[model samples]
Target: MVQSDSKLHEVALQKLNDRGVELKEIAELVYDLQSPYLAELTMQPCLESVKAVIRKREVQNAILTGIELDVLTEEGKLSSPLQEIIEEDESLYGIDEILALSIVNVYGSIGFTNYGFLDKTKPKLIKRLDDHTHSNKTHTFLDDIVGAIAAAAASRLAHDNPGISKIMK
Candidate 1:
């Protein structure tokens, strides 16, 4: 990574930390999601995989954009009608997932499958973010975005380890 890329990643990581999202939380989610498929899995690889995925400019942009939207919704800064839609996290508001898919799409088709599973299962921080949406707090897009990051990282992990033959679909 270049100096500017490193700076961007640092800024993005700071933004995530500001929003109460931890790299370790994301790394743990990756491990939990991919552990079953690997005969020998460790948190170090999972953590590194998450770092690799987030290092991408595309993923950084997604994280910043999604988290900003959630912050806007939480602060009631968004304009009416749309604000209501996002604050409520309506079923029709799918842009969050759309932005998140940009991150998943980086890895390949397998990332899509992993994303689908994590989104459906809402494991770890995903479940926390989803539950937070019900309160005065808002995580309209963060949950889905984080899930995509984890899913993408898991896919990267599978791709890196040559011994793993059958990844669960």
Candidate 2:
């Protein structure tokens, strides 16, 4: 049976795909985060966790909202102050982080720490996304959103595995 929100989920997935973010990329971030804790870890569970996090309605909404803003910024569609703040990804303009926190909040406390670590480390694909010099596209929101996804996915994996879940706590 299809959930009524399946369309939203598909769009969320598509938006990330359109932005050139593959599930495998986020899964790699997940694998990196959980590996030290889980020596026997495999990419399959990390990929599964990323998929499950993206499947959430909350995550879908954040993906849609953030991507829309980035697209608008790229097209120069937003107004002066707001556009500049997002385009430059100003340090003081923390609204992007706040939006990201919403996604992290879904998985409870563990996600917050995980998100912090990823945000600071900018591991793997996230580093590429956040690199302003590499691309003209402004990932102002996408960077944080992508980080949140990886963090939340890692948190989900930790929660699912009782042994590491405690270590996470």
> Which pairs clash in the backbone of model 2?
none
Each model's lDDT comes to 0.87, 0.91
Query: How many clashing residue pairs appear in each of the predictions shown?
Result: 0, 0
Which 10-residue window of candidate 2 scores lowest in summed lDDT? 160-169
Candidate 1 deviant stretches above 4 angstroms: 1-3, 133-135, 166-169
Q: How large an RMSD does model 2 have?
A: 2.9
Query: What lDDT, from 0 to 1, does candidate 1 have?
Result: 0.87
Best by TM-score: 2
Would you estimate the TM-scores of all the predictions? 0.91, 0.93
Model 2 global lDDT (CA atoms, 0 to 1): 0.91
**Could you give me the TM-score of model 2 versus the true structure?**
0.93
Q: Model 1 reaches what TM-score against the true structure?
A: 0.91
